[model samples]
Every structure is written in C-alpha cells, then in structure tokens.
Target: MLNKTLVPQSVARKIQGMIQTGEFQSGDKIPSQREFSQQLGVSRASLREALLTLETLGLLETETGRGTFVVGGKPSSSSHMASWRYSDSYSAFDVFQTRIMLEGRITSLAAGRLAASQLDQMENLTQQMEECWARQDLLSNVEADLEFHAIIASSCSNAMLRSLYQMVREQISETQRHPIPITEPARMRASIAEHRRIIAALRAHDGLLAQREMENHILNTARCAGLAP
Candidate 1:
C-alpha cells in the first residue's frame, strides 16, 4: 500500500513502477479511479493527479469512452510534450530560446562564485536525476533537474541576472519538465554527462567553458522536445 502521506508525485512513481515491471503491460486498461484509490490507499483526488501525471509522461493514455491504457512501445515524439501551460503568454520555443540565453550567462557568472557546498549539492541532485529516471520516477527526476539548475542560478554573481531568472522561474520549470515524455533514455544519459561537464568547468573556474556547456545542455534538451533543430 502507498503511504497515506505520499503526494501525487510519489503515487505517480508507484504507478509508473507497476508499468515498468509489466504488472500493467502495454495497452492494458487500468482500474477505475475508485478502484485505484482504494487499492493504493490514497484519496481519489490524489489518484486523479497521479493518473494525469502518468498520462503527461506518456506512460498512459485515456480514451473518451474507454478506460486508461498503458502506452504501447515508444511514445510518439510528435505529441509527447505536455501541453504548454504558458501558451497564453509565450510559446515553448520562446521559453527555450530565452533559457539558453539567460542560463548560459548565469552559469558563466556562477563559475567562480559557487561555494563547495553548492557544488556538492548540484552533484548530488544530478545523481538523483539519474536514479529517479532509472526507476521511471519522471516527476522526481525533473524536480532534481530543476534544483540542479536553481543552484547555479542562485550562485551566480550577477544579482540582476539572478532576479531575472527567479522572475521567470515558472516558465523555466515548465521547460525543464516539457521534454521528459519524449526523451529517449540515451538523451537523458547525455544530459547527465552534460551536467558533469558543466560542473567540471565551474570547478576549474572557466566561465567561458561553463557557459558553452550550459548553452549546449539547453539546446540538447530543446531538441528532445522537438523545439529546436
């Protein structure tokens, strides 16, 4: 049974695990919300949230008249990304382009300013991202990725740049989560490697190299989301 205290993200991880282990095979229709809530020892509200999260991850699909089913084979990259919540204000492409410019400069400024503890935390979060992805915990993986980038932004020496990043934090976070559904495992591994390279550049106090690595990381992620060439 799932812990009563477990949030939607945690419950989503549990359901994702079941799918990964084939307990819920491809194309299998899952139980109803009432049944799932009872079985998982979670509230119906929590169950709904978890289901929505799984659907966004491309692990499940709900039909208009039928129940939800586990997705078969690889999820379609064309429609994998979750619907852009900020569409009313800006396009996903706009957000990604802005991120590349803003974060690249932030990383460069943070290179020599980050303390040892901040660096260590970034390293730990990167590791957590890998472990969470391996377990099919997409939400947690994205959370870890967010924190890893947040550390760099917070550590940047330029106060104005840091404030600008915080102002767009919501869009930045959405972009980070946007690519996960269609992200191949290989791309995830490459992203982890990119994080390591950025860390190395920061440790060496090489601002230019850190900026380059940061830009490349965002560009690669944008490619995964089909937002970039």
Candidate 2:
C-alpha cells in the first residue's frame, strides 16, 4: 500500500501524467502555483513540494522570469533534490554573491553604530534561532536568520543600501532552502555560530573584523549551498 504521507508524490505523478499525455508539452509553462493548487484542490505548499521533485527529475526547469517549463521526459529516480523556490530572475549563486558583497560592507558600517535596542533585538532573534534549531524547526530558524541580517542592514546607516538589499530579500530567503547541504544539523549549528561571531564583532565595534566575519560567513554559506567554490 502507498504511504498516506506521499501527497506531494501523488501530485507529481498527476503532473507527470499531464506531461506524458501532451497536455503540457515540452517548453510549455506549467500553471502557476495558485492555479495548480486551485485546479488540483491541494495546498500551495504541497504543489511547491511537487514542483521541486519535478525539477530534480528534469521533467521541469525553472527559468529566469519565464516561470516553470515542461521538459517532457521520464522522471529520474537518482536525480538530485534541491529547492525550486528560488527567484526565476536570478540563480541562487547570483543572489548570494551579491549578498556577500553588500552585506559584508553593511556589517562593517553597522559596527559601533548599532543602538542598544538593535543589539538587544539581534540577541533575542539569535536566541530564538538557537531554540528553533534545537527543536528541529528549520522554517522558523530561517525567518530569524533573515531578521538578523535585516537588522544589520537597518543599522548600516545607508538608506540606499538597505533599499537595494530589501529588493533581493526574497531571493535571499530561497538560498536557505533544501539540497544546499546547510540544512543539515551540523551546518545549521555552524551557521548559528557564525551569527554569534558577527554579533561579537559588532559588540566590539571592530568594523574590519565584523566585515571579515560577515564575508566569511556568507562564503561558507555559499559553499554549503553548492553555489560557490
């Protein structure tokens, strides 16, 4: 008997059938998540999960600003799994590379300038992240991770830089998703530790060290995500 928990797989097979039957031919853009979920009577989360599987099977390819496209091929059981939630306009590598450049400088500028409230907020968020990690709750952890960086962006004293970073924030969130290898517990703990290091540098008012720490953290993250050397 099939497992009751295989909801996404069931959705995947249905979409696969549509591909096989030529309803969604090669090079065709599949329906949007909202449309698919509505048509299939399933949640958007489940549909997204199914699309990630299809992307791994090479039955679909997500393109920049082009939506998800059908490749019309058999699903490969051995294909690697990764998040398909990234921005279509920018690859994960592109987003993180930009982040490393911007955030490293931002952290440097924020050093010695952060208000007590800001530091307290960051400390609270970091604690929340650690607690979430202990509970194995990745989603909440990712939220706190984003918030921590956002606070640093706010502290940078550069309104334009903050605006630019905000523009790509969603793309940044995508990099935290699965198949990047950082989702593993050890890597997640390492990430939390890196956060602490950045915090320490900020507390010390050491601009250069803060910048270096932020850069190193981002580089390590990119490496774990398979986006950088």
Candidate 3:
C-alpha cells in the first residue's frame, strides 16, 4: 500500500526506485499497468502516468506489435546510431570526424566575434582545468576540459552553430571518458597551455590562428588519449 506521507512524492520517483532495485532489467518486460496498480495499491491512472514518465526519460522503448522493452542504459556509439540503416556499424573515427567539422566552425565564428568578457570566461575555465590536472582530479579534469571548450563554442556569435554544438555535447563527453594516464603528463600541460593561446587568438579576432590552435588542441588530446595515430 502507498504510504500516506510518501504519496506526496511523484510517481516518477517511485518508478525510478523500482528500476534501481532491479525489479526489471535491460530487455526484461515490465509488468502491465493493471498489475502495477494492484501491487503498488495505486489507481490504474497513476500507474499509467508513471510509465509515461519513465518512457519520456528514455528508460523504456515501445514497439508497435510488441510490448515495451528495457533496453540497456549504457550509452555507446552504436546506440546513438540505432536509427541509421547502415551496411556496417559506425566507428569512433566517424564521431571524431563530425566533431572536427562542428568544432571547426564554432572556433572560426568565436574568433570573429568574441568579446573581452568571453575571453575572461575562457581563461577562468582553463585555469580551473590546470588546477584540476595538477591535483590529479581526473574526473574534474574531464569536466573542466569539456566546459572550457563548451564555453568557447557558446561564445560564438552564431546561435545556430552554438545549438548544434550543444546537441552533440553529450556524445562528445561520453567518448572522452578514457583514463588520462600519468605516463604522458606533458601532453596534458601542453593541451592546457594551448587553451590559453587559443583564447588570446580569439581576443585578437585572429580567425585563422584561433581555428588552427583549437583544431591542434583537439587533435593533440585525441593523440594523448591514444585515440589517434
């Protein structure tokens, strides 16, 4: 039965709890709305509401002729390309290529239009990155790293370009989750320094130099992470 006090909580939270407890797993069929209503002592309407909430959050996928399925939650390159009718699977290189195109335009636009305040913002984010690296805060380093790049892209005067970069931001973040081994400390330091240089180029409205520095920074990161030749 539903607790009187806990009833104040949203239905989505209760359903989220069920998923976390492994009441259902990937590819497992969830109970019907009627069954859930009886088990949880809630109305059928409440149970349906909960299911819709879960569906909206990407927790379940429904097929036309079949019931909903609990697809795995782990994100991957192939997972994002499920809608693509490919003769073969997409590769990490495909994603890198797209990033190169997307970020290249963003850097070029940012270079032409960055304001003094935006330069200061990039500098601050880059400084945070250096501190995180020196302290060996690997996760923080990754977050700050992404944020600094994101800040640069967002500062670009072109709204459409900024939106496109934000759309693929999650994919880029996921792909960059590799461990930064301490064996190559110089790579990280050089990457951080390049960020400052790129900011200076943008502040000067030097489009070519800013674009080149930004491209070199990403390529160097890929190489350091052993994702490049």
Candidate 4:
C-alpha cells in the first residue's frame, strides 16, 4: 500500500513505474477504480486524480464504456491533452496568448530584482525538470516547470502586474500543463534550453532579452500543443 499522505502526482509516478517496468503492459486494461484503490490503499478520489494525471501525460487512455488502458509504446502525437476545464470562461489558445504577453512582461520586470535564493531555486527547478522528464516522471516535470515560472512572476518589481498574474494563475497553470501530453522529446529538450536562456538574461539584468526569451518559450510551448503557428 502507498503512503497515506502521498499526493496524486506521487501516485501517478508509481503507476507510471508499473507501466514502464512491464507490470502493466502496453494496452492492458487497468483495474477498475474501486479495486485499484483498495489494492493501493489509496482513497478512490486520490486514485482517480492519479489516473487522470497519467492520462494527461499520454501514459494512459480512457474510453467511454471501456476501462483505462496503458499506452505501451511511444505516445502518439494525436493523444489528446486534458480538456480545458476553463472552456466556458476562456479557450486554451486565449490563455496561451495571454501568457506570452503577461508573463513576458512580468519576467522583464523581474530582471535584476530577484533574490539570489530565488534565482538559485529557479536553476534547481530547471535541472529537476530535465531529470524528471528523463525518468518519464511527467507530473513532476510540469510541477517543477510551474514553480520555475512562479518564481519569476513573484519576483516581478511591478506589484500591479504581479497581482494581476496571481488573479489568473489558475488559467496560466492550465496552459503550462496543457502541452505536456503532446510535447515531443526534442521539444522538451528545447524547452530546457529556453529556460537556460531566460535565466542567463535575468542574471545579466537584461530585461528585454529576458522578455524575449520568455515570450519565445511560451510561444514554443503553444506550438507544441498545436495552438500556435
């Protein structure tokens, strides 16, 4: 049984390990939620969340009237991303476009204003993202990516812009996670390189360069999700 305090991301990692290690083969129908939850000693809600995370990472596929199945081989580019939960309020493309504008400005404002500790954490998180992706730990990879961006946003010198970012953070986060399922390996490597470029700009106190790097990073991510040209 898994630890009681484990979050869905941790549980998702466990299930992902099972698939990678052949305990759950490609195209195998996963056990039903009730049985799986009991087997893992996790609550149904937690198990469900874990399953959804794996599904979003293209490690699992759920079909109507059919149980979830492992996606054994390389995940297809056609595998769908998690449905935009904010559809009624905003489209995924809308959020991506806003991020390119808003985050770019925020990152520009953050230049030279971030604490050393914050910069160090961003560097660490960027490294963690590379490690997580190598291990196929997609949930952790995205979480690290989120924290890396959050550090830049929180460090922005403009309070109003920072406050506005906070207000729409949920949608921003969705856009961050939206591309993971379809992100190819080369693109992921490029993203890591983009992070390094942004960090270099920030460290050099080059606001314009930081903003450009941030915009390019978001634009590339949107392209990965097929939301941008």
lDDT of 4 at 24: 95
Task: Give one digit per residue, the lDDT tens place, for model 2 in 111-220.
Answer: 99998788888888889988976754334565678789989998887888888888877576556544322245677678789988999999999999999999999888
Better of 1 and 3 by TM-score: 1
TM-score of each: 0.77, 0.64, 0.57, 0.86
* RMSD per model, one decimal: 4.1, 10.3, 10.5, 3.3
Q: In candidate 1, where is summed lDDT lowest over 10 consecutive residues?
A: 72-81
Clashes of each: 0, 1, 0, 0
What digit string (tens of lDDT, one per residue) describes model 4 on residues 22-44? Answer: 99988799999999999888888
Model 3, runs deviating above 4 Å = 1-90, 179-183
Supply the global lDDT for candidate 2: 0.75
Which regions in candidate 4 have their CA more than 4 angstroms from the true location? 1-6, 73-82
Which segments of candidate 1 are over 4 A away from where they belong? 1-6, 21-23, 31-49, 65-67, 72-79
Clashing pairs in 4: none
For residues 1-229, write the lDDT of model 1, one tens digit per residue. 2433257777887888787777988879999999989999988988897787677667777888998888843433325655676899999899999999999999999989999888888899999999987866676788889889999999899999999999998788888877777788899999999999999999999999999999999999998888782
Single out the weakest 10-residue window by summed lDDT for candidate 2.
73-82
Better of 3 and 4 by lDDT: 4
- From the highest TM-score down, the ranking of the candidates is 4, 1, 2, 3
lDDT of 1: 0.85
